[model samples]
Target: MSIQDQEHTAEPSSSPADSAGTRRALRADLLRVGKIGGARSATSSAAVIEGHALIDRRTGVWVPLAERRRQAAAGSPADQARWDRLIEAVTRPTQPTEVSYEKLVVRVGSARDLLRTLADTLPPFVPVAEVAQRIEQRVESGTYPPGAVLAPGRIAADLGLPLQSVHLALSDLAGKGVIEQQANCRARVPGANPFNDRPRQLAQLLRALAAGGAFPPGTALPGRRELCRILVTGDKPFAAALRLLFQEGLLERDVRQRLTVRRGSVKRTDPPKLPAPAGHVKSLRDDEIPEAARRTRAWWNARLSPAPAALDQVIDQLGATAHQLVDRAQPGSVPPSTAQQQLSALVARTAITAAAVHHPHFELRLWHAACLATAVCDLLALLDDLDASRPSRRTAMPPLL
Candidate 1:
């Protein structure tokens, strides 16, 4: 009967086809999948049976449709019946079965290769220095396409960097005329970017060296050009820094010819050791902050706008601590895929009741608490979904149509 005639007849639409026809239909499904990139694409395309062949998703091979048609022509009635179900599956819209293809990167090698593979699998940590350097490098290297908006907040969140640092770096770039920035704080690279922190560090080191008599009182410092080369700061910034020292009475200069260190400017590196407190009295040691607490405090201070005096100090501390934390981690430890996830988990798990109760801005405190609660619930739900999708939680596969 014709397909239209069969529909009019009072009979079941699907029944067992002969093995030959079933195989032919199967060939068609495979060909559809092979024609696409993989299962993911094939599932979308729904192109299981084309005119001539079956595409094999597994081996990425295809079988000729002409051969399948011949096979079907010779198949028993039962074989044709099986083809009905398979054709419905391949040609009709339906949810796809879950299939995962694992990529195994194999190499013929010895110990070095083994170690390298192991190393590559470990999670990589992004520290502040590298974060700053990466941004500057990309901007200078023209990695960001022209006219792209540089959003510091988005970059900070994506990279798990302190937002303040991104703002500072971008601001510095703007100040140096390396980048074009609007008053609204959006920035784009016209060409320039960050100079390293070495200049300020060099300035401080010179202060310390001068205190240590490397440049004695009444000494005439080297010419500004020489200082620029030594300090790694451009002439303008280096001169500005020197003026600060001069204003502080650390140095003096003849109007026409030279600069000299003030005789009385050099001082002790640190205060003399304090005497031990008597028993039952509080000592400075008793109030010393722990490293982690210090870091958290610095984080808070560093984020404040108007760029307080403590910003640079805290940033330096944070950078050093970042390295220290990495060092303390076990060598083979796996870094989390995302630092943001870890931060989210930490915030979710933390208790802020006491702070909320006593906070000056109690409404804001409650709002923040609400935000955290929402984040925790969302994160937990995502985790549950991921767990459900894994093989261990999967039920038996749905039977094919």
Candidate 2:
């Protein structure tokens, strides 16, 4: 055949049937390209071809060709180069091939399973404040009562935290006075020191009574046992309260050992400031008093004897002596020589109190008293340091040694 006849034969026929077949083949090719290029719909393919747009590979969105060109023109030379590469890739003709189907088998499971899987992958972080808060909550709720020891290893296991974190938390609590810890000892909830629960409560109640003029200055008070019965307290606490009062200079002892209110110590103008809610001497109804008193006396009888009361009285008197010494050492109120002498005496008394713990007749009460004495001595020492650091108000006393 001639050259023109060969070209005509290569071109598609213009007849109606042939034209319809050719259009169908072209449409199928465009559809195949759309699927491969990640065009979601027919409109996306139309946008790419007719509206001068390209399908973004990352987002699968059709970006306008004009906008891309404008950005490339305004951007850096590297950006323009990147734009050129992208446009070249989009415009490159792709071959038509067989479309393969992907199964995309999705296995659905419960949300719990997914969460557990995630939990296995991610490590949990436990903060120090969280551990401290847990301990504080337990203490406040009485889960850990006073005198209860807190073990760091046990806490670590319970909290799923590291042991070092627990120790740091405990040290922080100790510093804040939320708990107490000694060298080589575990942390513990602090309890009443130098006296048992009842004795401290009774002492406070008696102080309130004396200050409120229930027992006026120079007034001879009732017998210890009688006062104990009247106040719904035990004999031990009553005696301890009297000793405490005597130490505080609120009470005096006669030659016969009878307790009397000291002269010039009453503050009758103010109403009676009662003890906290935990005290035994609460505001009771007339009928409730008898039952409460009976219960208290029975408890006391079952638990303890009155033999230790005398020894406790001696320890308390020693604490009283220390208090007097500390008072004499008050800054700006006494001469330097006098303050030094008083401090020296205070130290000797404290050492004696501490030494008593090693004595043959040492008891739990004596140990508590020693602890109290040591605490008082430390407090006095702190005050002395503070006084030394402060600017002296008196010309006779210098700020520094």
Candidate 3:
């Protein structure tokens, strides 16, 4: 039925209170009808309602369409003409516009320009010597102990310096014998007396003796010279071994500074089982990518306007790249060199994308990408270690005769 016919339908006469109730019911019906149509139709219906409805100046309530039409009919010619025009406008069909797609051309020079601008905005480059000095201080202070893997990536992150700078500093330290570095492996602090396994061996022997009840709790054991002779070790190694025992709370010094087995120290408990190894690359990528994306979304929402379509595209692309990297990182699937190359490419692309979009949080995004790349690289290194050990393990196996 036409809207005019629906409006003209007669209602039963009621009290003044009923008039307000009737108006609310009519408004609800109009809204329900609008919702029954789809979004565009609903929008058009809402526009028609807004165009027809008039506010009561005194009552501050919306005048119903029927009442407005009645007033227009009784009023001058201009009011009738205005109402007629509104009805015609509401009934008119909307036209579809021609869809034109434009190609987004990103010039290489423009990206370079953006990079230059970003570089200008960044903090001054930290000196390689300064980075090396900081790491040296950390090493001397025992923050990085012997046998600890000194990952360049981790050091770079901690120092907030470039990875290359950290690498150079590590190389210098390694050259000077401050740390040890080998090809395709992270740098490591040199252990005290690398040639001597005597201290560790003596430590194990003493621990076994204590566990076997040779030295019971609260009993004063041998002197330093006696231990050296009995254990067939020198004074230096015996002292070091005793130090290890002291650290383990198995041995303590008495009033005369004699070595005694500490009371309540002997507990013959089974060693805890180690957990099975997992795919580090897959686990790290899974954990970090989504977290980075969430942080990016929150950061953008809090500080900037809603993200544009291009930002979403960049995020999707990053996710796809991460997935691809995880797949390639499977055991013996892709070599470390290839994985490293791909990761480097991903980092560069992420930086370029951030620059292209003029993202204020570009540094944050780049850091996350670099961190993921570093984790993947570390995983590759671990895989390399496992592979290297396999042949040695095979050779060491007793021949089945």
Candidate 4:
């Protein structure tokens, strides 16, 4: 193709006034991938209206209406076939492939198969039903509502579960968007939806706030200890429960230390970042399949380029997430300096140091996490460097000797 032919084409502006025009153009092109609902803030009211106008009809499976329209206009068989495969690869599962060379052979599998295999490979997952039930009871009673802080230790002590298990449950709930966690280990329920029990907790808090006018909307609701007393539980369950509400976007903390509720019926916009499963890697395909497949591969390789992050950095980011989580479990507390010191001491030991230095995966996960932490440390250092900023902002209090 000539350079001119390959030049980029700009998408029509998704502006409010132009909705009718675009709807008329792209209406017949709708393709569904996932559940999409009524008008959202992210998509202006007009765009939502136009979107529904194009492909509002319900179907068992989703097809992107706009992309299909573009494919119909590809003007050539090769172009059309390419777009078709691209759409399929994204929407449907590709068949497994076998590779052979001399005595070596391997089979590449689908994401579904891999997840299933991993599930089977894992040791039986212990159920947390009892703990979940206990938390449910507290929520039903007047003890804990939305916007309560959690203390992992206290909860662990009360529930008779290891502190680590309680922490794990909280992590799982947070990932599920069943709660909202703040920096200082505080939590609140936004009650944006009733489906996941998040809405109930949130509704309870909203009703209380409405009646009591306690700490005006947008105020940091309360410290974890204070919330724990009201909720009649430790922090973990409270934080986990509040996470769901926060995900729904009913309540938000403002810059000036206020907790504000979105007065309107706005749906949540935050995307959840589910942790990638261990040993999961994007699949690479072999040369085969139909004509559509070849073109599909070429186009996807160009556009959906894979740029893997360094392994070391990923571990550090994971560590940072862990540290933040731990801090929340024990509010107004810091990780023991001696713990980190002991970890360093272990690294210095000859046997451990040698094993870590030699093991590639181990080294990758460790160093990657360290590299990320270093970047964070660098930013903190810069904050310290800024002389004009307020002393409070410029420096954290010095550690006690």
Error of 3 at 362 (Å): 35
lDDT of 4 by residue, 1-401 (tens): 22122112312323122435434322321212021222241245443333232222321112343254335433333333433543443332232221111101011122122222222212232234434445445544423345444456655665555554455455544544555656765543435322234335434533343223232333355565654433333466567656655676656666765555545424322212223324443212111112222332232222211112333333323333323322222222223554333222221221111122222332122322232232233223322333223333332323211
After TM-score superposition, what is the CA distance of residue 260 in candidate 4 from its true location, in Å?
A: 37
lDDT of 1 by residue, 236-327 (tens): 76776776787778878756568777777877332111122234333112122244234333332232121223333332332233222222
Q: Candidate 3 — which residues are off by over 4 angstroms?
A: 1-122, 192-401
Model 3, 103-187: lDDT tens digits are 0011112222222222321236454566677788877755555655677866766556777657767866786788899776678
Worst 10 residues of 4 by lDDT: 98-107
Better of 3 and 4 by TM-score: 3
lDDT of 2 by residue, 1-401 (tens): 32223324433322122434434433432332233322332234332332121122211121243234426344233324434544444332343221111100000111112222212212253445566777777667544557666778766765566675577567667867889997767788888433335566566655555554445467677786656544555576677767777777888877777788777876653321111222222333324333433433332333222234444444444345444434434435344564444444334333333333223322334333433344344435545564765455644333221
lDDT of 2 at 129: 56
* TM-score of candidate 1 against the unseen true structure: 0.23
Per-candidate TM vs. native? 0.23, 0.26, 0.23, 0.18
TM-score of 4: 0.18
Best-matching candidate per TM-score: 2
Candidate 2 lowest-lDDT run of ten = 99-108
Better of 2 and 3 by lDDT: 3
- Per TM-score, what order, best first? 2, 1, 3, 4
Candidate 1 residue-wise lDDT at 109: 17
Comparison by lDDT, 3 against 4, better one: 3
